[model samples]
Target: MNNQQWTGWSSGAQQAEQHYLVEPRYLAGGGNLHHVADFLRASGWSDKSKTGGPLVFDSPDKSVRIGYDPYTQPGGWTISANPADGQEAWHATFTRQTPVEIVAGFTDALTRPRSAHAPNAWGPLQEQRWQTEQGQHFTAMSPDGGAWLQYHQSQPGQALWWAGARNEHGRIWDASFTASTPMHLIESFSAALADPQQVMRPRGHVPPSTRIRTTSVSVRPDELSAWQQARVTAARAATWARASWATTRPRHTTATGPHTQAGGRTRR
Candidate 1:
């Protein structure tokens, strides 16, 4: 979907607190947001804040949002323990509950290639259909055969597998598979989503150690540019030095010098 529709999905109430973590799915419109807020209010979320917004539930212990944004993308909106200006504020990062099937699929996809019979698809997979065995119907949509859009639909209370694909040619497509264990998947994806860079770590951080770290380092635009340029120059210099060394290195020699002997005797 386009950006506006996507943002609407993010602003929906289904995204309230961390429920989106369990499902990690966004409603297509703002209506879901209202529905979520109403649900929270009915569920006894406090409206006593100065902003009169939903209160944090003790069980989950997280605030819920009750607002909208024009540029928010699906899976991008979040509720904080605090609110701003009598309205729900979205955090730059938030947590989600992981699903089991998604966890299984993600683990499987990473360790093994898709089965020969499985569809080699691309893009985040949406749940449209499923089989009793739990194997889902998937589709790959792309102009280049290198990428596709895919989805996996699982039995109820599962995670929808999702991600963008990359190859030698860069990112080619995004996709997701249905997950049987949603809570786990939500937990895992929420951690990744909160810190996109974490996924690039050699080994993922364990939950006990998954604390969010932030620094307030500030740099002027020019300083940032200079730092980037310095990095580029260093890389170029290293490449050039390696190439020069490769070209200048001496070649291997055979044992044909005076040190060589024909019958165990030195030949000078």
Candidate 2:
């Protein structure tokens, strides 16, 4: 953790004073999409988009496809996976307004090898002492009362899990996860929501008209929160690697594969 303190607005903070704490990405609508894109590219996903069309990347084994389109209706980013070895396929879509960090949670988990044990979705929030209503249909609210997540056991074919943020004015943002969406992805998202690390935002840009009043802290113009700094560092590394690869690799390298959709989970 960076000991150097800086000021920013936080709905999750205990007071309107300077401290390190991560604000929910749903509270405001800004994040760097390039960071996640570069991460996927660096991890061996092959680009499959046309020069002027929406960006598309396919996993090396062609089991997954990720897409980003500014103008796509309903959602601008999408991920679809279909494994050939009888594993379930899953699809997820994110609205253009969905914060990149939230989406990155899923992508980050996706790239990692599957864990030997099943993931527990509620554990992350529980660790933070979030309030929960236990039942067939489960729900939990953040300690600050600004964000919440729920599981609709009865709504099997529908979106089984839904999460959102709100303030005095109204709902700021929301997302849903389908039944087929992997549990690990849901767990990763919950972990991100519960992460204690703080995000850096300009004082003037404080967001969502919070239910819990926020305090301001001082930050140097050149300083950035740890999360922000990590994204910047990843983007820089990806860019430098691409430039180096272009200069060193032969121009004739080519890849080709067929894309197929099979049975799996659906998410939104």
For each candidate in turn, the TM-score is: 0.21, 0.67
lDDT per residue for candidate 2 within 2-22, as digits (tens), equals 344443322343333333333
Summed over model 2, clashes come to: 8
Give residue 20's lDDT in candidate 1 (0 to 100). 15
Top-TM-score candidate index: 2
The sequence of per-residue lDDT tens digits that candidate 1 reaches over residues 1-268 is 0111222122323322211111111100111232223333433334433444422322113443322232344332233334534543322221121222222232222212224452422212222221112246354322222223334555555435444423343442233323422233333332322222211000121121112222222233344335345534544465467568869976544477855344563422
Candidate 1 TM-score over all chains jointly: 0.21
Clashing pairs in 2: 7-217, 7-218, 16-215, 21-198, 22-197, 22-198, 89-264, 180-265
Minimum summed lDDT over a 10-residue window in model 2 is located at 13-22
Best by lDDT: 2
What TM-score does model 2 achieve against the real structure? 0.67
Give the runs in model 1 whose Cα sits over 4 Å from its true position: 1-162, 165-217, 255-268
